[model samples]
Target chain A: MEALVALSIAVLTASGVWLLLRPRTFQVIIGLSLLSYAVNLFIFSMGRLRSNAAPLLEKGVQADPAALADPLPQALVLTAIVISFATTALFLVVLLAARGLSGTDHVDGGEGRQ
Target chain B: MSFLADHLIITPILLPLLAGAAMLLVNDRHYRLRAALGLVSTLALLVIAIMLVQLADVPAGDASLGRAYLLGNWPIPVAIVLVVDRLSALMLTLSAVLALCMQIYALARWHRAGLHFHSLVQFLLMGLNGAFLTGDLFNLFVFFEVLLAASYSLVLHGAGQQRVEAGLKYIAINLAASLLFLIGVSMIYGVTGTLNMADLAMRLPDIAAADRPLLEVGAAILAVAFLVKAAIWPLGLWLPNTYGAASAPVAAMFVIMSKVGIYAVLRVWMLVFGPHAGASAYFGGDWLLYAGLATVTVAAIAVLATQDSKQLAGHSLLVSSGTLLAAIGTGQAGVVGAALFYLISSSLGIGAFYLLIELTERNKTAGADILAVTWEAFGEADDVLPGEEEVGVAIPATMALLGISFILCALLIAGLPPVSGFIAKFALLTAAFNPEGLGATGEPISTTGWLLLAALLLSGLTALIALARAGMKIFWMPASTRVPRVRLIEMAPIGTLLILCMVLTVQAGPVLRYTQAAAEELFAPESYVESVFGAPRAGELPQEAEL
Candidate 1:
């Protein structure tokens, strides 16, 4: 399970970097979203990926660190996910506006064309 | 009054936030009301910030260490905390002053250029103030996003083709940086099992040898993310283009944004990896020094190359960041204090310069437009007639005021004498040269110290020449240029900032003493750790037991 998660993160990051290096704005946007997903998963895995374990503790019960999952990383990952979604939407709007203005999807606004 | 005093630290974040939301609900047509609310809120923030500064100055003892307000009254390390010390209070005051001045300037005309400008500015304030005050890493990330998001909207406020292109690049670059930040943060949390900065600091020393490498990797990645935001070389190439393309008031407010990155670097690096980090002490110090030097050199060249006033201001921002980074990399208490002073002066100077750019460019463009029309009406050959000899025209009062302000900004940026900039650079160089300033070990000054001094002096020279050249073109060489009709609202903000710089220069003694104390507090993080955790209550079984 650890190997699979690490492999998935590596693949997503590699693909994101490849796309981010592209000159097209749309590709960059997609790249950023992919990168953010990888990051979100990475943050989630910070808790060490416990299966069938609760993140919460019962009232008047002493917390067992070995049994329960760390809830902080989970909360952090959730916040990151929401933020990334909002930013992605904002990026898409910006990309569309850029496309309309420059009449091209190029990141440099077609400055290289001439 | 006690309740208000107890909760003073949170007001800087909450007031602007609630005001921004309320402003959003107001009808768009009633910009007047929105502007009034923003002004009043920012002014109140200024007062609160001042009070906070005073509160932080009063030493609350080794236990409390200057007021740590845990949100929801939860215990330390569990609830998010807002810690206000001398450093945070100083940052709050700086941001509040910048926001207030820029807010007033925006009301003049930029607010009308776009929808929700006032609200976005208010939101930006909330984000900036919160970032400065928050004690937890997660909250830092949240506040960073808040500021960046608001900045994205603010950058796109006065939409044009260039503005949109620049805004897109800015968004993309910042998003990538944010992703890296998350990865780095999670990696640190994974290794250390904590995200509260103080808690992380307390736990860093006890990290097992096997996990040390992982922690180093996380710190390195996190530093890269911060360096990118701070506009270090290579990663900062987008800054000039983006900041130059932003509208005047937005660009002015953004002066604080890069400083936010620097603040995080200083705070986190000093706390987590300072001399107290044992084997991990001064991690990534060498990289920061070299990258910072390169950033300074490149920014100086860019300053020399920039044709427009806005791009000049942007490159100046990079130069300021590089100087501070390099100074902090030196790890000298005195140098850090001097760098902090320089940071304040340069930020204010560049912000005022950004505001001045719009006024200067407006007249220049108006003059050029007239010239183009006249030349078109006649023939190109006739434009070169002997009767059309170009020479300096009579300057108006507004032009004179702008010229004075421009010179003051140039002097500050170039680190010329009789201003806070020169005093700051002097203090830094003095501290760098003095062996005693190299900490209690009295380590001899290395070649890096001399190299940094050279870079500092050379950058100042380059800035002087560049500003002289730009100033000649804009202020002196213009023949029969129309005087820009500067509004009092706009001019007053520029004057206010420049006067503040002057005040900093005049009151350099007390201010430097304050920054010195702040730097000492930063270097000795034990007080900070003790204050946050509150002496570790009996039967708590240690906070690290949760890990």
Candidate 2:
């Protein structure tokens, strides 16, 4: 499970970075989304892989910390996910605006005579 | 008053946040109420910041635990904590003053150029204040995003072809940096199992030997993320374009944004890698020093080459960031104190310069700067004698005011004599060259010290020349340019900012003394950790919940 997660993160990051370097704004936006997904998973996996374990404890019950899944990383990952989502939406709007104003989809707004 | 003082630490963050949310509800057509809302909130913030500074200054003895407020009345280690130490209070005060001045300046005309200007400025302030006051890394990331989001919208506020293009690059770069921030943060969490800065510091020295390299890698990546914001060398190439394309008030408000990165680096480096961190002490100190010098060199050269006044101010920001980064890298308490002084002086000067540029360049044709450069290159513009201009033609008040403000800004940014800039550089060089304090002098300065001295002196020289040439082109050529239509409302903010710089010059002794004390407290992290751990929870905890 650990190897699979790590391998997927690596692949996503690689492809995302490759796309990010492309000239088209659409590709860059897609790249950012991919990169953010990788980061979110990386944050989530930091808690160490646990299956069939509770993320919380009863109000008055005590349990060894190792028996329960680490909840802090879960919370951190959730925040990261929301923030990335908003930023991606904002980026898309800007990308579309740039395309309209500059008359190109290239990242540097393309080479065109004004 | 006593009750208010207890909660003063949180007001800087909360006041702007509430104002921003409320301002969003108001119609943008109601400019009067929106302006008044911004004004009242910023004025109140300035007052609260002053009170917080006073609170931070109370001598807490050896146990100099700063004022720590755990949110939701939770215990320190696990809960989000807001700390008001001398360093943070100083930053809060600086940002408040900048925000108030920028807000007033925007009131003249710039605020009408876009929607939700007031709310964006208020939210930007909230982000900056939160970044400074938060005591945990995760909260820092959140505040960082908050500021970046506001800045993105603010940069695109007066959306033109240039602004949109520049804004695209700026947002993309920062979004990448944000991802890096998360990666580094999560890596650190994996290693340390704690995100609270104080708790991490307490636990770093005891980590297993096998895990040390992982921690260092995490820290190095984190530093890179911050250095991008601080505009260190290669990572900072986007700054001049982005800042130059931003509107005047937004760019002025952004003068403190770079410092946020420097502040983060300083706080994290001192707490997590200071003397008590054992084997991990000063993990990346050498990298900081060299990279800082490189940034200074490149920025200074770029300052010489920059033709536009707005771009010149942007380069000046890079210069200040580099100097502060190098000073912090030195790891000397005295140097850091002087760096703090330099930070305040340069930020005010740059902020004023950004505002001044819009007014000064208000009437010039778009190609005037390039044409002037060409004329100078061809030696067509001769040096006009003082006697030539004295043919019974008195200088107009607008010209005189603009010229005087321009010269003051040049002097301040160039670190020339007769302003706080000179004093700041003097103090920085003095402390850096003599790191052993007064009594322990006579140890020869290191090679890095010599390099720093050269970088600073040379950078100042370049800045002086660039500013002088730009000033002459703008002011000396009366035939080619018209006197910009200046308004009292606009002029007063620039005057106030310059006057504050002068005040800093006059009160240098007391301010330096305060910064020195702050530096001393920063270097001693035991008190900070103790304060965090010692902060009382609001109520008794359940038996099972007790640690």
Q: What lDDT does the true structure give each of the candidates?
A: 0.85, 0.87
lDDT of 2 by residue, B1-547 (tens): 7667567778888999999999989987798899999999999999888988887887756343438888887766888998878899999999999999999988766687778999999999999999999889999999999999999999987676677878998999999999999998999999999999999999999999899998888888888889999989989999988988887888999999999999999998899998899999988988888888889999999999988788899999999999999888888899899999999999999999999987787656535656453233112111211122322223359888999999999999999888999999999988888888766777788887798899889999999999999998788864346676777888889999999999999999999999998888889888778777876665577554542
| Segments in model 1 whose C-alpha atoms lie over 4 Å from true places | A60-63, A111-114, B60-66, B366-396, B437-445, B535-547
Query: Ten residues in a row with the worst lDDT in model 2 chain B?
Result: B377-386
Question: Candidate 1, DockQ to 2 decimals?
Answer: 0.71
lDDT of 2 by residue, A31-95 (tens): 99999999999998988889988899877676788789999999999999999899889989999
Candidate 2 true-interface contact recovery = 0.75
lDDT of 1 at B110: 72
Judging by TM-score against the true structure, name the best candidate. 2
